[model samples]
Target: MVKSVSNITPFTLLDYPDKSACILWYAGCNMRCLYCYNPEIVFGKGKFTFSEMISFLETRRGLLDAVVFSGGECLIHKDIIEQIRLVKAMGFLVKVDTNGSKPDVLQSLIEQKLLDYVALDFKSTRESFLSITQTDLYDQFEQSVQLLFKTNIPFEIRTTYHSELLAKEEVKDMIDYLKFNEYTGTYYIQHFKNNVETIGKLPNSHTRLENHLPVNTAVKIVLR
Candidate 1:
């Protein structure tokens, strides 16, 4: 079969909350986020085939509790549904990290009960969505969010905050959007790590996030 996974993180306790997991870093992404840290994964080609990945996972059957399908965008893969089914059949819980551009694929996974958890990237407010992600799929992202809301699966909505790309007001708008949609989950604003090379040249964020955060909002906003 054709290769699709660029690399594999043998183990991680951080990526998947409360579960010991391994990360499959798939190659390529639909969006060109300026602050994307995985420039290599986004622009590189896969080094491992599905068979290779499964063989690797087979060894960790009992050691690992879950598998994190992270990418460039895991849902963009044509055979993602089947691939996920194979993993799920191995008695391993599955989690997907996505940009929320492929709601149709997300919906399919939800309907098939393939996903145990999800980490959705809420790039920015609708007005600056295109400027940030370089994609005009805010509607699709919103659709994905709504789909998750109707499901019983656990999920978290997070944003990679960069002082240059997004303002405190935009973050408030996103919080407002989530509140308006009746989302009662934690909204994470992760500060962009400046140590790594990004897709675009970005300077280190000097602004203190705590000072700019909205006060006493209904949605639980956490800075990571």
Candidate 2:
């Protein structure tokens, strides 16, 4: 069977930031983050081939402004570049949501000018990266960050904050790392949704994230 996207959200307004978009959820991942909400996508197989996705896009070309390629780490898929090319040919902008485990794939997309925007997940500080993501790819994540830094393309670095998995100090360390790298964009801290089923067992956070955010950093911090 040809590995392909697992699902599609036909339309969404909030995901692409000011543009109407649809989300393509790819299957499988290189990391197993404890708090990942999309365990089914991470563990399951693709449901839609590229041709099917393209046909779906063809029907929505005039209605949607962009396509958000998300996943189980969308970059891990081998056909992503070609898939993006097909989507782009349809006159839709492309956005990718990634965990930054595949810098080489990212670089290829960037070089080909296939991506219009990116939402990169900054999973954890280097020391705790393995514990949170269950993968030793912090260096690859860092390399992806650097690739974004060198480009003119717009992107956002965000972290899913679950107090039990990440401490206030660790969040600060991540912010400091971004600052030291001279990242001058907004760093979004999205609170983990308590009711959703996660990849691992977790307790609801009792602490307020607003109180835990670092004070007056060079990077603009936004709680979402």
Best by TM-score: 1
| Candidate 1 collision pairs | none
TM-score of each: 0.97, 0.96
- Candidate 1: tens digits of C-alpha lDDT, residues 1-224: 78999999999999988899999999999999999999899999999998999999999999999999999998999999999999999999999999999999999999999999999999998888899888899999989999998898999999999988898888888888888887877888889887789998778876658887778888998899
Q: Each candidate: how many clashes?
A: 0, 0
Residue 132 displacement (Å), model 2: 0.7
Q: What tens-digit string does per-residue lDDT give for candidate 2 at 1-224?
A: 57578999999998898999999999999899999999999999998888888889889978999999999988888878898988998999999999998999999999999999999999999988998999999999999999999999999999999888898899989999899988977799989989889998989966667877667778998898
Top candidate when judged by lDDT against the true structure: 1
lDDT score for residue 5 of model 2: 88
